[model samples]
Target: MTTTVRQILQKKNIQKIITVSPEQSILEALGLMAEKDISAVLVTEGERLVGIFTERDYARKVVLKGRTSKDTKVGELMTQNLLTVSPSHTVDDVMQIMTDNRFRHLPVVEKGVLMGIVTIGDAVKTVIDQQAETIKALSGYISGEMSI
Candidate 1:
């Protein structure tokens, strides 16, 4: 059986997604992210996901460029070109994409609607869980063989 995004979503307890408007200052977004203890926040315009603002974006675009976070708009520093996945996508599929793109988070979309977000930590944990289950099954099989 394949692990799907839906399965992961079912396991997650917190469904609150932090969002920021493109017109908002980077400092404001950062404040929300800090308060939530999240590394990234979706840049939305009335439910439309326009971009993503992350810590990396802050480091490279704002800090490196000497742009003040209090004055810069999130849209100016956000990553506009995004890579997203659907609810039906397998964990392996998303793992590959995250690895290939060096992405820490991937937004989950369904029929052009944003559903949730998955992090690299989540994907790696899922893979580890799958491996542990496989190992347990193999160990059970070996024990049964020994007894037979």
Candidate 2:
């Protein structure tokens, strides 16, 4: 069976996206994130996906540099030229990309348009859930509850 990213979105039921301007200060972005209780925000110019700014970026870029977040723009530190996936792509494909790139977040794009983003945790959960189902099927077969 094929599981598309659209199916995952339908199941995940995510509704809102936190978006920020690239011109905004990292400090301002952090405050917005604290208020929203989200770990990452999509960097946008109008509706375009320019980059992603996450808590990890804050730690590595701002804190490590010893530069004041108030003085640092997200555009200067955000991850650029993002790796993206089509919404119609499979969960396996997403998992592969996330694993290979060692990235926690990925933007979903279609026809050069941004739709949404998925986290590494999301992809891993899907994989674990799928594995659980397989294990259950094997157990059922071993118990002769169904024909294999």
Candidate closest to the true structure, highest lDDT: 1
lDDT values, one for every candidate = 0.88, 0.86
Q: What global local distance difference test value does model 1 have?
A: 0.88
Clash tally, candidates in order? 0, 0
Best by TM-score: 1
Q: Which regions of candidate 2 are displaced past 4 Å?
A: none
What digit string (tens of lDDT, one per residue) describes model 2 on residues 1-148?
Answer: 5667777777777786678999999999999999988788899998789999999999999999898999999999999988888888888899888889888888887887777777777777887888888888889999999765
What is candidate 1's TM-score against the reference? 0.93
For residues 1-148, write the lDDT of model 1, one tens digit per residue.
6799878877776567778999999999999999999999998899888889999999999999999999999988899878999989999999999989988989888888888888888888888998898888888889885331
Off by over 4 Å in 1: 145-148
Candidate 1 local Cα displacement, residue 87, angstroms: 0.5
Model 2: lDDT of residue 67: 87
Instruction: Give the 10-residue window scoring lowest on summed lDDT in candidate 1.
Output: 139-148
